[model samples]
Target: MSSENQELRKVGLKVTLPRVKILNLLDQSDERHMSAEDVYKALLEAGEEVGLATVYRVLTQFEQAGLVERHNFDGGHSVFELDSGEHHDHMVCTETGQVFEFHNDEIESLQKKVADELGFELTGHNLVLYGKPKVN
Candidate 1:
């Protein structure tokens, strides 16, 4: 049994061809984040017979199974990335639409401090910064 099959079974998802293909694509792709259209394009390039609708459906299933995380960025765009169980924030380049992942302990500490000062314990948070690369 392949690891992808095992992963799906572990997540209580029945292993199907489309699910396996999508899972493998998400796992092996260098671009950690991908939209459904991006995924469909890749599958087509790879000569997979899957359809765009199936890609959307499988991605939603993955998200529900906790196999991936969905981020709805500004401009109403959404992307999916495998849930690696590590916490990190994001930065979106306004011009290129590139998503960058970052981790900063200082920022994390500050957020916790602010939450505590507000009489609320921090349970979770998602911080996304948008920017344009410096021309210089």
Candidate 2:
């Protein structure tokens, strides 16, 4: 079985053409984050007969299955990316709308400490820092 098929089976989702196609797109995309409209446009450009609504539905399903992670950036738009099994945070460039991924042990430890001080277990957390790129 193909990797996509195995992923679908592992998530208890029946393998389907649209699911496979979307998963493949996400897996192969150069941009880690993509919106539903972006995905729909890519499908159209690729000559796939997928509908916009179907893209939205499939993306939501993937998010629920933990195959993808969704983020609502400061732009008030949501983007999806494949969950690569590593925890990281995001930094968005406000000027160019670029996204960058970063991991910091200090930040993670501080978050844990804050949660512990509050007597709450940190189940999960998402940190998004927005800034402009340094210009020469």
TM-score of 2: 0.96
Model 1 alpha-carbon drift over 4 Å, by segment: none
Candidate 2, which segments miss by more than 4 Å at Cα? Answer: none
**CA lDDT for candidate 1:** 0.96
When superposed on Cα atoms, how far off is each prediction in RMSD?
0.8, 1.0
Which candidate ranks first by lDDT, i.e. highest? Answer: 1
Q: What's the true lDDT of residue 96 in model 1? A: 90
Clashing pairs in 2: none
lDDT of 1 by residue, 1-136 (tens): 9999999999999999999999999999999999999999999999998999999999999999999999999878679999999999999999998999999999999999999999999999999999999998
Against the true structure, what is each candidate's TM-score?
0.97, 0.96
